[model samples]
Target: MADRDFLLWPFLETRHRDWAEEVEAWAAANAARLSEGDTDEAVRNLTRAMGEAGLLRMAVPESGRLDVRSLCIARETLARHSGLADFAFAMAGLGTGSVTLFGDPALREAWLPAARAGTSLAAFALSEPEAGSDVAALSTTATRESDGHWRIDGSKTWISNGGIAATYAVFARTGEAPGARGLTAFLVPAGTPGLTIAERIEVSAPHPLATLRFEGVRVPDAHRLGAPGEGFKVAMATLDVFRATVGAAALGFARHALDLTVARASGRQLFGGPLFDQQMTQAAIAESAVDVETSALLVYRAAWLKDSGAPRVSREASMAKLHATEAAQRVADRCVQIHGGHGVVRDHPAEKLYREVRALRVYEGASEVQRIIIARAERARAEEAARCKPTP
Candidate 1:
């Protein structure tokens, strides 16, 4: 099992610790079942199960204020037992994040409760075929109709929970201004006449993903999230809250990798002695442990900052995501090396973790993107400091 001592860190509270323990128990008990079926069926079942257990309540907070630390705790704990479980839980929060943060009462009333209860699924549709990191380049358009409704036309790719989601928060250009200023978010229910799941994407680590096509899909003005020309703000704000939790999920994968490594090294024999007796093996273990601890520190620091009411934890969150994901990849790699032939075999713990940890670095603002964000933030801070300095 992963280390439990991190729960005692000052970054958490009594309630967070309790939450971690509860999720840990639930995940441990359901670990086997989570990996049992096709990806789509497994995710649907997992969401329902987590909902019934009231675990999804954390994803959709009652007070409409997300407790970032609790989110980190839940993702980290759930991820340790099953990557699929973590994916299901994370999507529940992310898919509904725009609505939870900026939806009108009617939108929230329609989506949040059912999402929180796991009775329905939600998705955030932002990236298009041409727009991934370049949010300003999105080509999907939403035109205002004379009947006080919006007619949306475009396509979204790489959307999590794409085909299965009951509702989607779709971002489209409304031509209110230009570039990012013209974008707007809308709440579109599934089975809309012109909306279709164009393709189901398969990945190294399987999860529910699809390319969604929208052709003249229409919704009332009430379906809009936030205000006109505010979709960029809404999407960024939602991502800002979730970026740190991505690091927390990576930390979970790293911790699990470490646990598997330790167990393998301690029991496996090599050169007439336990593998743990080898100096090189011990060194690898030591380094992997350090990676795990450091990742936890960064993840929790970002989470704590957000929970403490920091207006924006962009720099901290980027640091956490960048470091933890990159570090987790290293840790998982070392784990596979330490396991020798057993590591690469299909369905092995090491093989699964290797695939699982890789995608973290690429998604949710990739490692390269995180570095760019950090650099820009630092530059801005330096510029502000220079502006405030005395004339001396």
Candidate 2:
């Protein structure tokens, strides 16, 4: 029961509203299940449950056309109830996104159904020990064999669903050329001969993550996604779609935090009245509300642009992610401030939100990276404008 008012905006349709309701109902019903069990195990259980409940089917629908609005609505609604549940749903789509967009017919037939059904987990392995933000710096290598197989050798870190995934979409240098042009994406199943989970990574909020090693792991050329040199394009295209949804998830966190703040402000007493009676308190709530609305605008605008067949939405997507994530962090901080000392205590909603929102700012693309992207896009636009100007 997070805010439904945002759904009324022009960016959403009746189907979006219906889907949001369905996801919200599903999340509420499964709240207890999502919160129970070991942290890592709980995430797995939730993923399975999401699949069983048919919630994940939309992620890789049979139509093969990804509806960005549906994805954003799903993430926003699930995030309101449980961040872990949101993570489970998101990873299912993200890990398999490259395949959906670029895999050949056989590869898609082999892997996508299992992923959508949650029968098999998936991971995207691109960020390595030395190369995260800079895709060109990745040193993982995939050498060709006489048998037409490829041998992958290197490591990847900060991989989501790393240890538990049944398949990993690994990007390695195939040496077609230097830097980004040389990289290639391969679909390496988890139990392949020379692939191993080197270490599990821990963060403030618990989830299944790890560093993976590829020691001469070999897969048929058939497993390669797209062409030999299209890996970077595949990654970028996938990210363009999901990055907007990341903003939607951040909006969910901010919404929950705002709800908690409002509850506390309306009930708590200070001096002789409710804490919300003060002008200062009113201002903070108003500001948070504005932040939430603006974030939704940016998120859905990018999503809408993509769904309408925009070939590239790098600028809009970056703006949405950058603004929404940073705004969510600020809103979370404000909520904590409004809650007084209770905000810092463990297990509290505000406290949990504080931790959950921090990572969104760093992952996908960091805030700094988003700024750089936005600046570059603006400069390009300006140059084009100047070039098109009439002689004066």
Q: Per-residue lDDT tens digits of candidate 2, residues 159-253?
A: 99999999999999988888899889999999999999999999997778899999989999999998998888888998999999999999989
- Model 2 sits at a Cα RMSD from the real structure of 1.1
Candidate of highest lDDT: 1
Looking at model 2, the pairs that clash are: none
In candidate 1, position 41 carries an lDDT of 86
Q: Report the C-alpha lDDT of model 1 over 53-137, residue by residue, as the tens digit.
A: 9999989876788888889999998888899999999999999989999998877887799899988998989998899988999
Best by TM-score: 1
All candidates: TM-score: 0.99, 0.98
Candidate 2 residues lying further than 4 Å off, grouped into runs, are none
Give candidate 1 misplaced runs (Cα > 4 Å): none
lDDT agreement with native, every candidate: 0.92, 0.90
For model 2, give the 10-residue run with minimal summed lDDT.
Answer: 31-40
